[model samples]
Target: MRGGVELTDCPAQVSADFGGDTVADTADTRTPAQIEADIERRRAVLAETLDEIGVRVHPKTIMGDAKARVVSNVDHTLGRAYVRVNGVVSEVKGQFVDAEGSPRLERVVPVAVLLVGVVGLLAVGSRRRGGSARRRR
Candidate 1:
């Protein structure tokens, strides 16, 4: 009880009078039983705190927390990307469709024709290659 840890009859009053200092200059007035009880309570609290610290520093716990953070970040990034792509698609569609949602034939026809031309060229190129290979064989 050299420290102010000695149980006081009026701890609140003692703290208020002494600027809330836990160490007091007063003599230990707690009975042996009271001191023992206080020690036991302090030990239990200390043990619980140590257990919590151990769990917090454990490798598995740290890994789990890191994984959760990574997953959250990835999900957030993918969600934003999806929103941006959807916005781009909507903008492109808007350009090809009018206010009434009808296809702008002028714009649609040109794009369709361009795609068809590309596909036709690829098919013809492949067929020529195949025919030449067969003739060589």
Candidate 2:
């Protein structure tokens, strides 16, 4: 046996039992050159298959595919977030706008009052801290 393959003197019996025809061992009458050529052909085919598989499972190929998937997911997430934010902004704007597209004073006045109150509280806190720092200095 060569390379775990049985080198038979009567391959016709093997083919008959296997119910298949051999390429180089047709009628069990292959020359040595035919056998060598068949072996070389099979080796070439195997090398090509290995090369293809290597490219498919390569680190760079795998990383590139992963990066593409991540970028696509990020883009989809950002698109959905932008749509949701825009929808919320439009709803808020609608609440503050009248049928004539004029600003509603009632809503605007309350929001402005709240904002001013927050700012005044922050200013008062900062002034008190500044006064204490001045006393230390």
Candidate 3:
């Protein structure tokens, strides 16, 4: 069986190098204020693992029914939109177009704007009926 290819054991330990504590015993070994407090505790554990994967498992996963549209360059402040089926969340501002056509945000809307509020309520109902008409005496 030499060179015939046959290897199969069974264990589940693990640690070799990838476990850390080597690299010449981490060179300087903690200092500079404990390495900036371990880089602020690893950036607060990577901001709580990106808030548990972008605001709690990104709405739950995504891809509710795919093929949905309407996306602008939203910055923040409750432009909320998140959901991802198959992967979990389900639906919330989901999108498509991947191969680099551009737009791509796939869910994450906590309170999106909603069509700039129906165009500011039809611009205050055409500026309140465009004039005035009230003189009860």
Judged by lDDT against the true structure, how good is candidate 1?
0.82
Tens-place lDDT per residue, model 2, 1-137, is 22234445443422222334443333555677876787798799999999999998999999999999999999999999999999999999999999899999999999999999999999999999999999998
Ranking by TM-score: 1, 2, 3
**lDDT for residue 107 in candidate 3, whole number 0-100:** 31
Candidate 3 per-residue C-alpha lDDT over 1-137 given as tens digits, one digit per residue, 9 for 90 to 100: 32232222212221234344542222344457865776688699999998777753453344332323222334232244332243333222235334565545443232245567778999998777665433321
TM-score of 3: 0.23
Candidate 3 lDDT for residue 32: 71
The alpha-carbon RMSD values of the candidates against the true structure, listed in the order shown, are: 5.9, 6.6, 23.2
TM per candidate comes to 0.79, 0.66, 0.23
lDDT of each: 0.82, 0.81, 0.46
**How many pairs of residues collide in each model?**
1, 0, 21
Assess candidate 1 and give its TM-score to the true structure: 0.79
Best by lDDT: 1
Q: Which stretches of candidate 1 lie over 4 Å from their true place?
A: 1-26
